[model samples]
Target: MQVFNVDKEKTLNAALLILNKLGQADYHKIFKILYFAEQQHLKNYGQPLTGDVYQAMPYGPVPSFLYDVFKASENQASPFSEALELSKAFTVSRKDKIPYVSPTREADIDQLAETNIEAIMASIEENYALTFKEITDKSHDSAWAKAEQATETEMSYLDIAESAEASPEILKYISLQAENHNLRIS
Candidate 1:
């Protein structure tokens, strides 16, 4: 029930790192990979890898902040502009139905844990060849369906945890305590 605060810089760096590792990929594919990584991390660690809010869009689940960063990078805006420029990652063929990302510089991989990177890489390897529709279909799991049922745009971590069915009881107890104390995880 507590809101998790996302570190925009770290999230952007992680996104860049994923793109750098995977080479160029379409936006939808990138989002799907991120979603799968987040799911895996949440299942194992009781927290998401990037701490990014997910939205059940028509296409699939998307990390909302990362999507915004990608859009901002396209417009050359502020932190996103600087980060993408310095990282040499850019979105190409925006007018196309599927925009591709080309990462030319090394990402700040230190921002994320090795486990998270591994999960991301594993997700990429497993589903890289799948088309956008395939990825989207894969993402329509119990968590996404539950969120969609509630007419929720932003998918809840609690819902994801429940769907993953791997959250430790201790963690759930601690989360409940934190919620009761009005403390948010950041």
Candidate 2:
């Protein structure tokens, strides 16, 4: 399958939107919500909400690029420094070694589709109140389990597609297209 290229700015805005809805959350909670949103979109539409790659982290499936963006935001680094403007968008504080993130600015919801935003909102409603460990435990579904067994940290979209029960014909077509286009599956 051809790996979808994620629009970082759009994804960041979407993440911020979720954070805005939740009021405040730690990294683990934020990542779980994003992962669930991506899984829902992928299962229903054959495409992820953010088009971001996911990895099986110890805590759960994490949107890899978004995780990096969050880290950069915490560190006050380059690209994210300009795009996210963490100082304005969020306030970070440590509570017993875990950092809590709270949104200070409204997310640019214009960057995301209404349907996608709704899906994220639904995910937030469903899982937002769970403890970080509870959310992480819930995320150990087949997709993450499969990725956890892989030698590489990055999980394949094909794997997720399969776990989502995408039609065999669709999977075959994707495989053929990947071969024809010389696209890497993972």
Candidate 3:
């Protein structure tokens, strides 16, 4: 759940790719996985899923940012439409910014998004390992209270760690909480 402030276009492209891949009717599965990851993260962190599940969840295919961008377009086209516009609106360089390599068809885009999702998940998993180490180190007092206090003092680390383990659907929530924690600390 590395919540970077990505560009709107990039986010939108990713969403469109996912929706197109999952297909309009069966897109819920992608959403469900991401959402579930976020829920699992919240449960682990003892936090509620109030906002921004993308940052909280694990896995890939979280579509909140993409959905926002898709909805914002003047034309409320479905993922298919948006993706079509995106294929034309953006250049190859910009498409690289998105997870999907090509925007030709639903299956092609879907496969690309799925691959990107796996990469994202792998990235989060690796980062989680590192963050977990940091948290464990900072809280290495051999006492539960000390660990809790340490994490509380620098909650972003803990929050991100929690989110890194989250399901994809709930990842946005995890990201939101982590961002809030970072803001407070900053």
Candidate 4:
């Protein structure tokens, strides 16, 4: 089994990078649950070490970093087996809670959501019970209109958010629009 060795800083950095790249919604939807526990693992491993390995050994190629870490930490006072156990539990919880989808399917859904904001909003309203008033107030209608014009052709929520920074009020509306459609911040 291969294990990846990572220090607390490196582990935390990697996770944060992934979170930033993935956006809040996708991070919450897919990465957060998996990661919060990982954060706990980092917290528990109090000292910096030469190496640590397979925080969890699920049925796959042990991440090289994990394998290296495990191998390096073999003689340490407290190796990563315990943390690996927790990670395993975390993985099991995730696997039992949600099924994995192919990367292609994931990308297709992401593209569709980005390009089809209206439909995405409709679905959000239906599924998450989102409300228009919850997102925008009367004061922001003018700004919203202006932003709407800019975004009439471009379907990216990230673009809309980028362009519509007239005020906090306007930003709220943009956020609501982007969030309703599951748009990632670009």
Candidate 5:
């Protein structure tokens, strides 16, 4: 199984970039849009931009570490919330009994490449207006199904690349990169 090590800082900043554009958005929208963005990045660049480890969740493929940070931030009453460094940059609050995430500060755009920003912005435009079911359905691809059906829920980068329709050559490159990374992605 090819797993990319989570880049916590880049992950937070990437999520922040989405939230910064959305002003405040439901986690469903945030995660779904980012899932597509991940596919786009994988297809275009053959490397991860946010570098989050994806997990097959009920809603879709959720970035494991990013979701943990969001959960911690949203549940401030929990002791874990205070321990999360990302809470300093992002805030999750409820309105109408629905959780919404907002950035405490602007996204550090420097962490993202021009192509990364372009992909994310395009994904946002494409997915932001979609309903919960619509977006959730969109994320239910072969990659997610492989993780969802397995004992371990972690998504494979190879599966993700395949689901993104990456060419054989790009897939080979990604496989080699993941192998060389040895699960320690930068």
Candidate 6:
């Protein structure tokens, strides 16, 4: 598996879009929706939507960087500068011991791709109202199970695509993209 850098601006815009679409939602809802949406995008395209890696968490697959960003929005001390930036877009609060995010403004739609929006919208519609058990079961796919017992296990895009049953041709394309991306950054 190759490593790829995350696009924080695109990620922020994507998360904002989800929050705006869902209004105020709990951490589970936001992260789970993102997890599913990323999987769909990986299957349809050779790339992920947010380009942020996912971690197999108890709730399901959570975007690792966005997890930190959400923690930062919650006013927890974080080394990431995006913490404050995320806080500006979403006000995070706790109710009955569960944390929720409320969008402070509309999403930067110009920053999001049409297919990405479609994936997320479908995920929201499908997953937003699922029971905790339903979502956990749905999200604990092969990819998530691979890292389930590990702490903060970072999931690779290739593994995610594999679990989503992406075609061999698509997987090869994603691998090529990863190589090109690594070469560009390295």
- Pairing residues by index, what is the TM-score of model 5? 0.90
TM-score list, all predictions: 0.82, 0.83, 0.31, 0.20, 0.90, 0.90
lDDT agreement of model 6 with the native: 0.82
Q: Model 6: residues >4 Å from true position, as ranges? A: 149-152, 183-186
Per-residue accuracy of model 6 over 1-186 as CA lDDT, tens digit each: 335667777788888888888889988888888889989998999788987877777778888778788888888567877766676777889999899998888888888889989998999899989988899899999888877765637777887899999999998888888776672211
- Residue-level lDDT of model 2, residues 38-138, one tens digit each, is 77666666566887878888888888677776666666765644445534466667799887887768888888888789879989998998986789898
Question: Which residues of candidate 1, in runs, are more than 4 Å off?
Answer: 77-89, 167-174, 177-186
Which candidate, 2 or 6, has the higher TM-score? 6
For candidate 3, write residues 5-82 as lDDT tens digits. 334453443434444443331222333333333334344443422233232122222345443433333233545554
lDDT (0-100) at residue 3 of candidate 1? 58
Candidate 3 vs candidate 6: which has greater TM-score?
Answer: 6
Error of 4 at 133 (Å): 42
Model 3 lowest lDDT segment of ten: 50-59
Backbone clashes, each candidate? 0, 0, 29, 16, 0, 0
Q: What is the descending lDDT order?
A: 5, 6, 2, 1, 3, 4
Candidate 4 deviant stretches above 4 angstroms: 1-5, 24-51, 55-58, 62-96, 99-186
lDDT of each: 0.72, 0.75, 0.37, 0.29, 0.82, 0.82
lDDT of 4 by residue, 1-186 (tens): 212233443432332333233332221222222222232222223111212231211221122343332233332323555444323211111244442211111112222222232322333333222232422232132223443455232122222233323345544564565466564322
Error of 6 at 186 (Å): 19
Model 5 spans with C-alpha error above 4 angstroms: 77-83, 184-186
